[model samples]
Target chain A: MNLSELLDNRDGQVYRLLFYDCRPLLQHILANYNINDSQREYDCIMDFYLYLRGDEEPFAMLTAIKSEKALPSWLKTVFSRFMARRANHDGQTDYSDSAFDKIPDDEEDSRIFTISDLNTAITLIEQINTSYSAPERVIFFADIDALASNRHSTDEIISVLHCTEGNLRVMRHRLKKRVQQTLAKLTTND
Target chain B: MTDTLIYKYAYNQCTPDERRAVRDMLVSDFSECFAVVGLMKTRAVNDIESSMLKAPALALAVSPKERRKTLEKGRRGLPDVDACKNAPAPKALPDIAYDEEMAEMSEPIMIKEQAFGMSMYFDEMPLQPAPDFLGILNRYLQSE
Candidate 1:
């Protein structure tokens, strides 16, 4: 139905289309997960529509999936997360290991490590890691950003960083610990 | 998956067997991942919407006079439509005439015309005698 033409709008029609189109998908997903709340489903749909109103690329992307006629993969996660936040309305997210086990596959979570957050984390590392050498910091951030793109293989990373398996493992260990601390601070402060 | 394990998974650090197991678990338990998505959308709202909304108010606040001045300035540079549509026609050309003396020399003639300038130049250059032509012509008559 020429979704781009419809969605590349700062108009009422775009909102109407998104409401009619995404409502059922949001309902189906929530229903599948047994949340069963029409209000929450409507809330998710409204959130998506409002989100779409402010930007074009996301709408362009969502529209491009017209043939699929399903909730775009990312939005499914987004809607689910919306419900989860409603569930966690009290305060700070629980930071226990149980929390990790609870939501492992959510690539776009509260601690999802955004680019700005990553930049802040990098700056924090620079300020904090007085002992880490210049080359080490360079390799560490470079490797982390590449990993974040989620496109590289382990062998590719090892070769690019010019490190052996044992050395790379140690580097990853150090990076994981540092990133966890930095992102924790960044998320809580936000 | 442990938080460390999830971090490793995000970075492609987990081995294949570990990766498979973790993915299976996450898929089997998909609903909890919603909170993470919720946080992401919250961060994105801050990331984009605020900046986008700021630009429009600044755009609209430009004084009407300033906008009019800019519009007039842009119009000033455009070519005049009347001037383009009524471009004058080319001036008429003088007629061609054969020169009797030049024709007597039996030389090759040259003609040049400049259309817009409405000018033409004519001259005749000496044509070199060629053995082949003379031989062909010889059969029709006596050689000079």
Candidate 2:
């Protein structure tokens, strides 16, 4: 039988498929929002399952889905609407366009490091510091500072660090990429 | 997955429809959102670093440690760090080409095999028992 038929039959395998598939969605909601309670998280996932099992509209919507690939995004929309509605019922979410603006978009990218992303990067550096020797870590952090300080010329960095210009550029670039890779790993580690 | 649309979205260079598509995904696409944020952060830093690379170095006013602290401090957030530690594992983001034909198209899967623990991103808070639907479902299966 097709996935839709298996879903319609409420097959155990289908349940497993969806459970694993949507687990990340559940994780995302719990991670990003202020909801920290495990019970609440359980209820949220259970509610989504019930919504999908609903014989009226949700089940119909599930069957209507053409591509299995769209299932994740479609489920996300359902969750978004679910959260929005729940927030409205609880008198918490502001429906105005301004509210989304306040939802906090990419503050770290805006050069504001007083937030967690930067701290994660730092903690990540310490965690992976073993990969690099002691001198490498010190020099990398220092050179990034020098370049970022707006006071150091490339020549000055090379001279002060007692390294060739190419070495300075290559080492700094490699270290920066490592930091980015670590952050990416954190996000993609499922 | 590295899609031009996601790149455009990161840069705020996409059209309204494309932006809407990406915005919708951001709600559930935690990994994608993180990747996009990383991309933007890199771009922002590169812009500044590139400019600084060419400019001549002046008098050494700030010590390297102090200067590094300032830059790192600018990026670090204790709360966000805590949040990262408490965060669960993230799945791959779908590479959906957002356009007029997007609705009809099936996204190609591009899952990365990277070693990362779900609990590594969140804070020092003790992990609570995560809800598992399969456990309940398994009970029903046995009963059946």
Candidate with the greatest DockQ versus the true structure: 2
Indicate the DockQ of the complex predicted as candidate 2. Answer: 0.02
lDDT of 1 at A9: 22
Supply the DockQ value of model 1: 0.01
Write model 1 residue lDDT over B55-139, tens digit each, in one string: 1222122234543544454422322323433444223222111111122332332322233121211112112222322232122
Candidate 2 segments exceeding 4 Å error:
A1-4, A11-14, A30-33, A90-190, B1-144
Model 2, B51-137: lDDT tens digits are 111111211122345434434534222122223334443332221221221222324333332322213322222222112212221
Every prediction's TM-score for the first chain? 0.30, 0.39
lDDT of each: 0.36, 0.39
Instruction: Give a tens-digit lDDT track for model 2, residues A1-190.
Output: 3334534332222333333334444445433444544434444554455455554566566667776556666666777677666666663323244543454434343221211343343334333332432223434434333333233445644433334444444444444444545555554552
Task: Summarize candidate 1's per-residue lDDT along A82-148 as a digit string, tens digits.
Answer: 5576456622223244653453333443343432322343234323222232223334434432333
Q: Number of the top candidate by lDDT?
A: 2
Chain B alone, model 2: TM-score? 0.35
TM-score for predicted model 1 compared with the true structure: 0.21
